[model samples]
Target chain A: MGEFELIRQYFMPLARLHGSSSVIVGPGDDCAVQRVPPGSDLVFSIDTLVEGVHFPVGYRPDYLGWRTLAVAASDLAAMGAEPSCFTLALTLPEADELWLRDFSLGLGNAAESFGLTLAGGDTTRGPLTLSVQVHGVVEQGGAIRRSGARAGDLVVVSGSLGDAGAALDYLPAQEDLDADDSAAADKQFVLERYHHPQPRLDLGKALRQFATAAIDVSDGLLADLNHILEASNVGASIELARIPVSPALVRLKGSAATDYALHSGDDYELCATISEASWVGAPAWLKQQLTVVGEIEPVSGLRLDGSAVVSGSEATGFDHFRRKA
Target chain B: MGEFELIRQYFMPLARLHGSSSVIVGPGDDCAVQRVPPGSDLVFSIDTLVEGVHFPVGYRPDYLGWRTLAVAASDLAAMGAEPSCFTLALTLPEADELWLRDFSLGLGNAAESFGLTLAGGDTTRGPLTLSVQVHGVVEQGGAIRRSGARAGDLVVVSGSLGDAGAALDYLPAQEDLDADDSAAADKQFVLERYHHPQPRLDLGKALRQFATAAIDVSDGLLADLNHILEASNVGASIELARIPVSPALVRLKGSAATDYALHSGDDYELCATISEASWVGAPAWLKQQLTVVGEIEPVSGLRLDGSAVVSGSEATGFDHFRRKA
Candidate 1:
């Protein structure tokens, strides 16, 4: 089948079930038209994942589809924006029906899970790559930002860290975890965490009410949290004991678990700051999701366990072009 | 410098100038937050230009950047939407400062020309590729669509067609064009047409009031007009003599100018259908921009000068995957 025909048969049907009131026009148009909610500011972000660079070359098409949306949507979570619609630009080496079908299914599932409508996109032929641009809405001037943190604010993170980073070791093995091994279950847990990161949309929404500053942890805790400090013009003192390290990470890295949590990337957890008063007023569910990892300070540099987290190899996160650094 | 630093130094400067009231939060945050004008619908589209596939592998970075945004913005023009903001997902093999600077300058020029703001985007490492997602705004329920053409509607096009397509042959010999040669000047004009297409945004917005249906002629005139026929479930009788072929194309292709105008792709002109009453009432300047190419008919297929434009090879435009077909 031709490129347009394939998209019509596989991708167009995926746009059918997800109905949003804001959408005026969906697929099969030069551009998709939708209304931004009244009294809201539309938030948009774009991310690209190239095969062999971002993910495994022959990774599961369904998983890649889900991950592509989830990773991009994590930025919306960071901005505390409500999911609205998204466009997907898929470039493939060839038109493989089976691969396209699986990828479309996963894309549909991600859109449904995130409450995002498939507005419009383009399908082209090239090296396998996916670029997704997500649009969401937040109340005007209400988006959580990295520049809002202040001294005396508590830094908190949702869920555990290090699990996704640790999963890198087992991702290539894919469905080949030895069922008899003692760490198989833990390996599976981390692998799933790495492959299908659940963007903390609900938590992000709740934080918009009280969080002082927010950033999603995609490039490890130290790297991402540093962004907040740099933007907010404040230093931070992170308590080593407070960093959340998953059991899976401990199983994989043991004494090196802290390294994975602090230095490895692709962990889609929210690292945010909350004033002490706001933390006290937070609901039980939100409190349960958040774990205090650090405190904002008046100084101008980051500290880990009261010692400076020196820059260079020790502190830098994922730098795509400067890989050797 | 790392990717982040490169973006901060180069792209961030481009983001500083285009201040729009619609922007609540711009490029620095996880997402760019903007407000669509009160009574308007948001229209968005994405396009990717891959190395060696869409353009020559080592084409001028400035031209690449400009063409990228122009191609994406053409979709907005086709939808009769006003430019708002755009996010760029740029993947590269390395962090080359000179290339990025020139590219960002071209991007800034395009955004400024189109009255668009640079929002949030991701920069990553991979094969050189660019994915641009443009967001525009149109009055709610006012967007032009291909499906809206009626049997008695007149088919019209904005600007001349096929110059860009015809320029493809001379693109490789760009620097060798002799200034003294008449054909060389024509070649230069078509080459500029190919490299820096001016997306007809103003013309599109003007047509929203009168045009029943619209599409950008990206994949040749005959091919794109066929899309209108398919979507409106109507047929068309196009006058070969009426097809707007540029003087440059006629100079280059001679007798085959008609073929280039009909069969070649990347024209980026708007093909719109207008009611007879609306056509009569259209402003003088708009009338000057638009040319009568055909008339929509009650039947369900396309005709060229009283002969059927056969399906398959004779009718098909550029298909990404089935390039040879």
Candidate 2:
């Protein structure tokens, strides 16, 4: 599709929305104009999901749209930024009406659910790639960062992980968790995670009130958390038993089972560090919604109950560019 | 390089620049947080430059870094917003240190050249793609939108067009430019426009004082300007004889006596419209530096004399996605 007509059809309408005072100008100009509240900081992040790479190709457009936006917003959750606005850059092969309609509906639902406005975006025809620029606001000086995790911090996670990764084992078109969901609870859990992964904005904002360091478990618990540890230049000995294994995940044994949660890349759960001297209890919302998985330490290198954990590329976690034939 | 090292070596240092107050929270987080002035609004836009799409494959990393940022900043320029900060989602196949060093330098130079600072970004192992998210600010209720152009408005352009399109004949390498660059002036001018485009942030902000509507000339003079006409529900007659042609472009088009400037893309110049009543002379910085290319009308459809523009599948000018053969 020509850029003009495609943009006019999909984005022009998104631009005309119920105006908010904070949104000085919405999707039509060179930039989406927004106002950070008096005591807030504007938080921004950019992510690109390439076709045949980030997501399986020929996947349902609606799910793809929901997942793409959700994946980008999860970063805000990781940083404890309250969602406000987002801009999407969509590059597709053509303006397939069916796909565009479903995708738009999916995006609309996500935007509505997160209370964010589709502020601005660009539509182009390319190799079916989607890049999302998401914005949120944290209190003037309260946004949590990966580098803030120091030694003696308590590491925790929002909700369970690995279900999205597990969902990949099912058929690609299996959009619903219940449809063809095997008796395997783990399988169902994985499918659910894939279909509707949650962004823990509530838990993240609560952490801004109490936690020290945080990150979303996108790459994996070990790999992603290792980033925090590396940034903080320290590590911890996790109580292997403290790991919150979902019922589906707990059933699997050996490398494959643990690999799903440890290195599977789609989980967007937040992996955060709390101050040892901070309050002993979490907010009720977080408590009902999250699981305490591990604690930070003064040591270097990741470990499970004082033992180091091994990584299996399983061809799952490595960068696709360098992947060998 | 791995993602972490790329951040530490290429991005973190740039993000640490305590330039303006907009950079409240920089890199080292899931998102970059900035502070918008009390009476100001945040302006943002996202654009992606893909290899073999936006630019020729095997193009110089330095120029790639520069042009990508320039194009995205041009959007800010169109909206009359002041450059504040930017985030980049860089996807590359392998860890090419030398290339990355040059790319980072170009990006850093561009960031510092404009008032914008490098806030935060994502570097992943994938196809060679650059997604830049640009942030700017406009005073409360002071920004330009395409929909603002109306009947009886003067259509204007900031600079000469088509220099970039001509330069593209020398693709992927700088050698092709050597044969064409018999004269020093011609050679340097062609290379400059192609490699390092100027984002007219100053003129864009200045337009807020005198222009009725504005947009950056990205796709082409005919296409991008038509965007204004379509949005304003008005048409315009542009004098092809009055179209501004760069010195290098004039020399290159001497044989064909062609006016590729009317249809060529990648100019990054600002195209605007001003009402006859609101029309005032542009600032000195703009008068000698910018061009008043044409005017607007009350009818619809873009025209180059008597011809109507048609969409296509070309990879360069106006190529949303050039299909692979």
Candidate 3:
């Protein structure tokens, strides 16, 4: 099918199913017109995933569709913004029918899960790359920023980390592994964690009233937290023992799980700093998913287990260009 | 340099130079936060241009940078929205410092010309591709859309058409031709037209009060106007002789200039439909830049010079995927 036909057959329906009322005009226009709620600020971020670089070649289209949107939405989750809408720019080598179908299905599922409207997008012919620009709304001046953390703020993280990083080792073996194999269940758990990592939108919204600073952990805990520290001009001391890791990841990597939790990327969990008073007063439901792993300090560096570590070091996290070296 | 350093060196400065007051949080965060003025609606669009597919390999990075942002901003013009901000997703095979410096210079220049803030974006390693998402604001309920054209509306277009299309022939020869060559000046003009086609932002914003429908002429006159026709459920009768063409293009293509004007893409001019009364009542400044090339009709197909033309026929315009076949 041609570009228009592909969009009509696969994407138009998805837009209709997931489009929000805020979308004054949806697809089929040069621009999508949307109404930002009165008194709300807008937050947006763009993310691109290139095949063979961001993901393995010939990865499942559905999982890719899910992964791309989830990854982009995680930025909104970090900003404590309510999900609103997004535009996708997808470049592909060919107009593959089945691929487009499955991709749109997964994308639609993600749009529904994240409560975003499909505003508009551009599809072009090229090497496979997907760029999603997600927009969200936050109360005026209520967006939690990385620069807001102050000394004495408690650094916390939502959900477990490092499963996606640990899952990397099992990706190539996924097809050959038997379902009844002893490691199959553990492998499946980590693989699912890799493929379908959830963006903490609800938790982010909840933190808006309480958190002093926030960031999404796509570049590993140490690297991403360094962003918060650098922006706020503060430091953090993370208790390595308090870092949470999924049982599946621990089972798969054992002693290496803590390292992955600290330095591996693509977890999509929100790492935020909250005032000690606010953390203590935060609702039980909110605190239940969060683990207080550290505290912000006046010193301007990252400390782990009482030792200062260099930020942006090779051991800190994944760097697209650095990986080449 | 890693992605962070590259962004800090090249992109962050551009963001600061073009950053609008509305941008609450700029680059270096998980998301950029911006305040949408109350009583206004948001307009956004995304466009991707891939190397080799969209432009020639080894094309001037600066021109590519300007062209990419201009092409994306054209969508905002089509919606009759005031330029606001944009995010860029840039992918590259390698970190070429000189290429990045020149590209960012061109991009920053365009951002200034179009009054757009560099919000935030992602950079990744891959084949070269740029996906720009532009956001704008329009008065509440005042966005001009393709669906609003009426049968009696007069079709109008701003500036000249087909120069960019005609310029394609000069691209490969740009380097070989001597500066003193007879056709050098004309080739230079057309090439500039291709590389720096102006988005009709002022024209679009002026049309917000009077235009029944509007679209940017990207995919040739016929193909793009047909979009307005289809969306508004109306037909059009275009006077072939009335379609404006640049003297440079006419000199280049002779009698074939008319065909190029009708069938070539990437003009970045605004094609709008307004009531006959509104067209007459429009200010002289607005009328000067526009040519009355056609009129909307009760029928549901396109007619050029009293003859019906198939909208998506191969002769009409360019289709990225269709070109492969």
The candidate that wins on lDDT is 3
For candidate 1, write residues B163-217 as lDDT tens digits: 8888888888897888888788899889999999999999999999999999998
Off by over 4 Å in 1: A311-315, B311-314
Q: Over the stretch A1-325, how does candidate 1's per-residue lDDT look in tens digits?
A: 7888788888886676665546778888888888888898888889899888889889999999899999999999998999888889999999999999999988889888988888888988888889999888899889999999999999999999988888888887867889999899999998999889999999998899999899999888888888888889998999988898887778778989988888766779999999999999989999999899889999978898889976432256687776531
Q: What is the lDDT of candidate 1?
A: 0.87
Predicted candidate 2 versus true structure: per-residue lDDT over A1-325, tens digit per residue = 5555556576555544445636667765667778778878888888887767777778778878788888989999988888888888787768787788788878777777776788877776557778888888988878888888777778887767676777777746464546454545656667668866778777788888777888888777887887788777878666656666677765644346666777665768898887756736655666666666677777777887777755222222444455331
User: Against the true structure, what is model 1's DockQ?
Assistant: 0.72
TM-score of each: 0.97, 0.89, 0.97
Candidate 3 lDDT: 0.88
Q: Candidate 2, residue B241: CA error in Å?
A: 2.1
RMSD (CA, Å), candidate 3 to true, equals 1.7
lDDT tens digits, residues B64-133, model 3?
9899999999999999999988899999998899999999999999998999889898888899999999
Comparison by TM-score, 2 against 3, better one: 3
**What ranking emerges by DockQ with the best candidate at the front?**
3, 1, 2
TM-score of chain A of each: 0.97, 0.89, 0.97
